[model samples]
Target chain A: MSAGSPPGVVLDPWLSGVARLVEEGFDQLDLLTAVDLPRDGVIEIVIHLVRIEDHAHVFGHVRLPRADPVLESVTSILPAAAWHEREIHEMFGVEISGHPDLRPLLLQSTSGPPPLRKDTPLVARVETPWPGAVEETTGRRSRRAVTPPGVPPEWLGEGS
Target chain B: MTQRCYAVADRPEVRVHIRDLGLACCAVEFASAIARGLLIPAPEEPGTAAVLVISGTVTDALVPEVVRAWEALPEPKAAVSFGACSNSGGPYWDSYCVTKGVDTVIPVSTYVPGCPPRPEALIDALVSLVVPV
Candidate 1:
C-alpha cells in the first residue's frame, strides 16, 4: 500500500480484476511486467491500462507465490497484452494459463529458470572475473578490489 | 616449407562490402556511420560481403548464426568487432544471456573500443583492415 501504488488483488479473481478495469473504460493496455521479490517469496505482476478517451491511467497488481506463479491470461480482454504477457512468461517464469502462443518470444530458449527470477544468477557475471576486482596502485598503498555487485560472496569462495 | 602465394586481382573498381550485424545499442553508432557515409552498406546479397562488422552485444543464441555468417563470407574476408560490447560485452559483461565477446565465436580482424564508438571509429577500423601497415 505504498504511495501511488496500484490496488492489490489476489490470484484467484485475476480475470475479473482486468474485466473490471476494461469495463471502466481502460481501453489500452500500456504495459505488463513482473517483479521477482525473492525476499518476500512472491512474484508481483503489474499491469497498466489507459482510457483512450480521457487518457486516464489505471494499474492493477496481483501477487503470486514464487514457487508456483500462475495467472489467468488477459489477452482475451486486451489483445495487446499478448507480447507483454509472452515476455513476462519468458522472463519471470510466471505461467499465463490460456495465452494462445506462449513460445519463447525474445530468448533463444527457456531451458533454465526464467532469467528474470531473482534466484537465477546472471551467468556472465559469475563466469567472468570482474575487472574492477583488480588492485589499483596509488602514490602510497594500492586499493583493495571489492566483490562484484549482486553476486553472492560465497559463490566466489576465498579470492574472487 | 612451400610458400603460399595469393594472386592479386587488378580490378580498380573493387569495393569492400560489409555485412553489418547491428545487435544492440551500439547499432545506433553503426547507423550513424552509415547515415554519414562513413560506412558502405552491404549489398542485398551477402555474396560480395567482404567485411563482417559486428556492432553491439553478441548473445549466446546468436553465436552459431554469427559464426555461420562469418563462414559464409568469401575468402580474404575480415571482421571488425565494433564497440565495447562486440569487443568484450561492455556493461552487459555480467548479463545472463550476452556472449562476452564476438571474437570468442568468430575471428575478428579489428576491434573498435567504445560503448557506442564515434562513426569515425568505424571508418578508421575499416581503413585499417583494408590497408595493413
Candidate 2:
C-alpha cells in the first residue's frame, strides 16, 4: 500500500475527530506525539490508532498555534493518552486541559523552557566545554567553532 | 579530593550492602550482574549498605535525592558511579536535563567506566573499595 498524509483536524474538533475514530473500531492508541514547527508557529499533534479486530489503522493530525497551544484532554475517550499528553505538555509546552493528573512526566526541571520546543536552548552544550572541540584544534588549524544546534548564536556571544 | 580510608575492618566476612540507584540502562546491566552472581546483592536498609551504586544518568532534578541517599549510608560508606552516564553523564553530557556526572551531586569513591560496564567490572570496583589492595 502507498503512504498517504493523515487527515488534518483543527484543534476545536480534535476531540470529536478522535472519538469518531474510536467509534469506527480504532480501539488501540499505537502512538501519540508532537512535532515542533517553529517556522509555521504551530505545534502538530500526531496520533495513530489501530483497530484490534482487522488490524486496520487510522491517523490524525491536529495543528495548534504556538502562542496558545492548548487542547482538551483525550484521556476520557482513549485513557492511554494520559501519559502521551503529559509528555507533550512538558516537552512542547502544550497545555492539555481537563487531564486528570497532568503532573511532570519525564523531565526533572520545571523552570527552564520546554526542552522539546524549537526555541529552547540546549543549555548543557553551551555551559560545558565540549571535549571534542579540543580534539578538533589539536591536529591542524582549527575551523571556526560552530554553535551547537538549538542554541542561539547570540546566547553564545557569537553575534556582533 | 579529600582522602578517606574506605577499607572495611572485616573485608571478607562483612557483607557489602548495596543501595541501588538504577536510573537508566546501566541499571539493567547491574541487575543482570546481580541475578547471574557476577555481583552480590546485599541488605535493603541504607544504614547497612556500605556502597551506594548510582547506575545510570544522573539528572539535575535528581540531585537532591542522590545527595540524600549518600548521606543516609553509615560512616565509611563509599559510592560507585556505576557507568559512564553516572561517571561523566556518558553520552548525555551535553543533554540539558542530565547532570554532567553523579560526582557533582555526591562524593563518589569509585567510577566504573563503560557505556554500561560489564557486571564483572562492577565486582572489581567493589573489591577494590573494600579490600584496598
Candidate 3:
C-alpha cells in the first residue's frame, strides 16, 4: 500500500483482510470503481470503505489483467457493492464473478462494447481539416476555405 | 400543361390543431408557444389533430415513436420540421445518436431553418401554415 492509502491489504489477502476490517467496524462500502490502462495491460478496480462508528475511511484496489478483467463480487460482505459492480461491468467490461444478477443496471441496449473503455469507438467527431489558403475576395490576404466542422472537403469540392 | 387551384375556409379556427412532439433543446419554445396560444395543443385523442409539429434532434431509437405519433394524426394532416437539428441534425449531424434529418422519418409540409429559429421566425411559420398548401 502507498503512504496515502489507509489500512488495507494487497490481493494476497484482500477479501479476508477487509472482512476483518468489517469486524473492526469499517462497515460501509463508500465506492467501487475501475481505471483502464490499455498500455500497462491491466485494469485496476478500486474500492473505498468507511467506518460508520467514527467515520474512519480507507481506500483499496486490485489490478486485473486487461485481456479479460474479472474480480469476485464483494456483495456477500457488502450488498451495497452490487450496483457499483454492475456499473463497472457495464461501463468497463469488468466481469464481477459470482454476482447473483449481473444483468444491465442502467443501459437498456447492448449493441456495442462497454462505453467507458479507453478503446471504445467514438460515434461522432467534428475534426475538420485545415485547408491551404486561397485568394481572398477582399484582397487583404489569402484565407483558408471554411466549412462546418465534421464536413469533409470532398463533399464541399466541385464535382463528384 | 394546365393546372387548376382551389381554396376554401373549411374550419372556423383558421388553424390546424397542432400536435407537437419536441425531443431536445427545442422543447422549451414548444411549451412556450402552447402556453401563449400561438399554437393550439391538440387533444389527447388520436386521429383528431391536423398537424404534427416536430422540433429537435430525434435519435434512431425514437424514430419508431415519432412515426407512431405521426400515424396517430388524422388524414389531410401536415407536418412541420422545426429548427436545424430536425432539418439536418444541426451541430450533431454526424452523431450516431442523432438523426440526420426528420424528413427521412416523416413527410414534411414545411421546414423551418435555424439552430434555434428566432421566435419571430416561428411566428412567421405559423402565419404561413395558417393556410394549407
Candidate 4:
C-alpha cells in the first residue's frame, strides 16, 4: 500500500476483473465506498472484499466519469454489498447497474443534490440549540444524524 | 504505606484497550501518562482491562492505522467507543471519507455516547471490563 496509491490489485478490463473476484469466492463484500475527484471529473469507486478464512482484504477500484458514472452491481452475487453500493450511489451519484432496488438510502427529498459530491458547497444550516448547550458562533446548523445501516442510534446511546 | 495514583499513558493503554475491544488500531492523543508507564499493563490474571476513548471523525481511512496500533499490544483488553465518532461517526457520517462507526472496522463492547465523554465515564467503562459480562 504505497502512499496515495489505491488499495488492491489493479485489473485490466475492470468489470470482468470484479466478476472474476466474485467467482473466486472472495465474495464477502465488506464495504462499497467512493471518492469524488472533482478536478478530474471522475468518481473513484472502491470495493472491499474479504476472504472468509483469515479476513484477507482485496480492494477493487473503478474510475467512472462524473458525467455518467455507472457500474454493474454485485448484489446478485453478494447481497451484503447491496446497501453499501446504494449508499455510494446516493452520496456520489454513481449509478450501479443491475441493482434490484436503487432508491435513496439517505438524504431527504428537500436536501438538494448529492451532498458528498465534490462540487457541492459546504453549506451551514441554522437551528435551535439544545438546553444548556452553548450556541454555536456559526449560524449554519449541522445535518441531522442518522443511524448507521446495521446499528440503531439508540443502541449507541445510554440505555442500550 | 501511603498509596499513590498516576495518570496512565494514553497511547499504550489505548493500544491495549483496542485489542480487547477486538480492534486492530487507533488514532489517539498519546497522553504523557501512557508514555511514563503510569498506566500499568493489566496483570496476567484472567479479566484484566482498559479503555479506548474516541472522538470526532473516525472513518475507513483511519481504520488501518488504528488496527496497526492495536496489533502491538497484548490481549484480553476492552474498548469504549467514548464519543460521537466512536459510536456513530458524528458529524462526518454522511461524508464519503467517514465510516459509520468504529464498530464497522472493530468490535465494540461498550459505547459511552457523548460528543466527548467525561473522564469518569471512561473510568466506569474500564471497571465494567474487569467485572465480567
Off by over 4 Å in 4: A1-3, A11-14, A125-160, B1-133
Tens digit per residue, CA lDDT, model 1, B14-121? 347666787888778867865765544333433343778898889888898889888887776889999998898888877878888998988888999987899778
lDDT tens per residue, model 1, A1-160? 2223346443347888899889989878888899888777888888888899998887788888889999889989899889999999999999889999998898987897788887777666677778788777676785665888888875565225
Candidate maximizing TM-score? 1
Q: In angstroms, give how far residue A63 of model 3 lies from its true place.
A: 7.1
| Per-model root-mean-square deviation over C-alphas | 6.6, 6.0, 9.2, 14.3
- Residue by residue across A1-160, what tens digits does model 2's lDDT show? 4223457444347898888888999979999999888777788899999999998887788889989999778999999999999999999999999899989999876777898886776666577664455435456766766545556775567322
lDDT, model 1, position A67: 93
- Model with the higher TM-score, candidate 2 or 4: 2
Q: Indicate the docking level reached by candidate 1.
A: medium
TM-score of 2: 0.76
Q: Pick out the ten consecutive residues of candidate 2 chain B with the lowest summed lDDT.
A: B1-10
After TM-score superposition, the amount by which residue A39's alpha carbon in candidate 1 deviates from its true location, in angstroms, is: 2.5
For B2-120, candidate 2 gives per-residue lDDT tens digits of 12122222243345767788889999887776577555433344344378899988888888888988887777588999999999988886677788898887888999999889977
TM-score computed on alpha carbons, candidate 4: 0.44
Q: Which residue pairs of candidate 3 clash? A: none
Of 2 and 3, the candidate ranking higher by TM-score: 2
Q: DockQ of candidates 1 onward, in order?
A: 0.60, 0.58, 0.22, 0.03
**Candidate 3 steric clashes:** 0
Every model's TM-score:
0.79, 0.76, 0.57, 0.44
Q: What ranking of all candidate models by TM-score puts the best one first?
A: 1, 2, 3, 4
